[model samples]
Target: MSPGDEHDYRGKDQGGRPDDPYSTLGGTRQTRTRLPDGDAGLPHARRPVRNSRSLVTITGVVVLLIAAIAFANRGGGSDEDAAAPGAEKPGTTGSAPTAATGTKPVQGKNGTIASGFAHDEQGAQSAAANYAVALGSAEMFMKESRHQILDTVYSPAAANKLRAPQDLAYSAEFLARLGLDSDGNAPQGSTFISRTVPVGTKVLAFDDDTAKVAVWYTGLIGMSGQDSTKPVSTTWKTWTAQLSWLGGDWKVTEASEADGPAPVPGDVAASRSDAISKAVEEYGGFTYAR
Candidate 1:
């Protein structure tokens, strides 16, 4: 087995739904609690009835009153006041600030992966997050590219230890399950999608020669085609890397993963396989920076 044959960062089955590699990490899964409503298998007691016509009249009046109040509030403020500087904006939800340090995102590239990050805390975080994306990418599924990526991102010692195991994990059986050829290429007319998007990064620890950073990210993986059984889906995870400033660059010394601070799933309808394939082909990824 070669480094290119490795399954993924998570060394688990990559068949239909790839298993969460960070499950063994110390975070526990949270479940929502359901509260029982008013009556529990009890028969309802009958009550005296009021005039149905009167009840309808009262409900209609209440609704109209609420609507009138809402309209009044909408018209309460003056246009100048609404347009004033520093005025609070309506329908604006809070979000984290942009992950920019004003430094160039990358100084150079080692093959297709970004390299030569800044030497400060922000640069270390940026390097770790981008490295996570590369390690989790579809390119890592192939032999030659995987070797290049491992060599680029990981410390020489760490890469040596991981290469053989990774190769074994991405064996022929695993590739078959993911509808890919032994070389990790998808079939003709099929698209294999694997991408990692870092939401944010936290510098857990930092120093002159070493730093630790955790990247909160979301990933998309699977195959897309007319007959694909393993349609692409999204997963949320957090990756922590212990990085060493080696060869004048931050390189991964060790890494681990954990379940995410995931957002609640939304109600967007799933797209058709063909549409998904087309979108994957049309959209290109970015050179992420912090």
Candidate 2:
């Protein structure tokens, strides 16, 4: 953690962070932990109780949505240092943006995803942030692209283990529920938007060859079409990745998610679907660096 960045460090199991609703790995986790009351500034910050129907479909899609780049949920461990190196006390009040750094984001790519990080603390953080973006991206909804992401950012064993279950989880029925096709595309004249904006990254722990990093993020999901039932909405989450230096890069071996440290929503009136669609099309993402 850098000087003056303390406000942004969401180190290990903070008191107001999620409890159980966010323990997903491989998109099968149905229970999501929202922020405890102490941090609920927004009217709808806390999620309502999960129903069987919700658990069956929405849960699967959410983790996939994170994978699809609608992105993350990672909780720090109970110990302050366990979740992030140089982390703040669990009871700390709010979050701030990560400070800018001199280091440039890694420019290499494995297919479309970024790759080839330096083997160090910043490298692990960069890996976690980038992987969170990929897993949480909208493309994770599509089969081939999803597979490619799994193989790219995760350890081979972890990717292999997660694939079958995730494929089952993101079923044809699941896509239909979110207004997406089997190919994970939006209907004609509609745009399915799922994007994760990584807010900051903190290294919880690290060594010569392994590290754990946490990524705080805000994401946008839902369809950008006037007729869409699920209109584009935003969410806040923390995703922690247990990573290792494997195959010459940082690869995720395990992951978990938790909700909020979210801010109060602004009073801005919602924009039209066409406007939202155009913005999404015009905006480009960045290569996140720690």
Candidate 3:
């Protein structure tokens, strides 16, 4: 297969849903996963409850509390509850407006543009992949553009914490170390490649209002050229993002990276800078799958 067609990163099979996107990396998807709940390699099963009576009593109390809270919070028809000029119905704020309500295909949006992504698992994974690509790109190496991206990609709290450190990480000294100019621009003759080729995506959790997608991928980093210090090295990372399908597109509520969970390298031999440069130019990127 051509490099561009090497993988299906779109997270869908030919018919979609039941069948996942075919992985170019090959074989069945049996990689061990450590989820947020800390249960790794276990089939999705609830642990057996030990104490029946105590559990029932505790559950009844919790249910009663929840019911009481709901009753307390419930209100008579208030001004805010009444849908205003063009606002959505009450209790449905920030929900994806185009969620599949019938046989009708769902519409997607990015900002105000028509994106056409269904508000589903497939759509969330697609958004997460694209967002990760944007966040980890070479554009983040630039100041003004980096700020814009940071503000766009992260939640307000995360953006606040990320701004200073990110600025420091992509500073002139760091750029020089990575064989780039002061502005994070590579030498004219060399191509600066910073791309995350997603291996596969999994929705660790999904809901109507939010989704947490685990994007496991290998990325290419480093500058190209004879004297280039950080020669395009391969690394694997799992990027987890809490996504909200707001204002059309999935916006990252939070994001963080974890080391590896890398796969074994391919038997294909590593090429030199010239070959890599040529290959990069000749071979365009594709969506990856596991």
Candidate 4:
């Protein structure tokens, strides 16, 4: 039970079909989520309706992988063993990738998400990591929170640009398949979890006005309930965000994701759906910073 070992972040994309690398974040399987009638302008996935169930239900088989993401970046262990917190395992490598710099995570909040980052490489990476969390979160599946996510993470122009498409991606039809209501609420007695946790960040490209940051992350997504057909699962992804120093903070201009450089799965047996559901309620998420 490491810091976030039971609460990884699973994913889904706003654009593209289930076959698209970025599209299927819950797992590798393809779900044909058809575009609603008269929405031909949308990039809706079309697969024959099967057994009167939603297609995205068959999308991916998630693996549960909870690893510390934001806490690893807060950096307070300036002790002698500072360089190797991950050495708890027999052959584990030093935690340089998740190494913290004693830098405090941003305290500023933008509607439950961190904001007000510094205008530097560190700030850019922090923003990207936190933004990735917001994008892949359960909130992102809900209309209101999804709007807030875009507005908080992206620039006005970028948010506006992505709004309609994002809404389409999480439409009622899609939610119905995932066993959620039109408002993204899970069925009674069930808990729906969609979260993203960044394991590390990299500055792929940077400039005075803009920066490109890549966040290596894992996500947990699915319904945790006794009768849940879609049990909680995991996905590994690299979310690359293009940020601009706008409004005195790093804002996202664009973002895209790619499938993993995922590690081999460990031998831990999967948790019961009830355990996952309870964990979702008990474990609070974090504000990622670097």
How do these models rank on TM-score, best leading?
4, 2, 1, 3
User: Per-prediction TM-score, please?
Assistant: 0.66, 0.66, 0.57, 0.66
Which lDDT tens digits does candidate 4 get at residues 1-290? 12543433343453433333323434334654556678766554443223312334433333222224343553455434444554442112343556554345575998888988867777788989999988898988888888988999999999999999989988899998898999999999999999998999988887777999999999999998998888888999999989999888899998888999799999999999988888888889988887
CA lDDT of 156 in candidate 1?
Answer: 99
The sequence of per-residue lDDT tens digits that candidate 3 reaches over residues 1-290 is 11222323221333333222222223224443346666644676333324344544554565466656655555444435533467654224353433322211225333322244457766676667666777777778888888877666665667788899888888798888888888988888887878777766777788886889888878888887887777888889999999887756566788779998987888987789988778877986643211
Tens digit per residue, CA lDDT, model 2, 214-254: 89999999999978999999999999999999978899999
Instruction: Evaluate residue 215 in candidate 2 and report its C-alpha lDDT on the 0 to 100 scale.
Output: 94
Highest lDDT: which candidate? 2
lDDT of each: 0.77, 0.79, 0.65, 0.77
Question: Candidate 1: where are CA atoms >4 Å away?
Answer: 1-99
Clashes of each: 3, 25, 3, 13
The lDDT of model 2 is: 0.79
| Cα lDDT tens digits for candidate 1, 55-143 | 44554565466556555555335444534376433212231335344446678988878999878777788899889989999998998
The most accurate candidate by TM-score is 4
Give the least accurate 10-residue stretch of model 3, judged by summed lDDT: 18-27
Please report how far candidate 4 places residue 183 from its true position, in Å: 1.7
**Cα TM-score of candidate 1:** 0.66
lDDT, model 3, position 245:
72
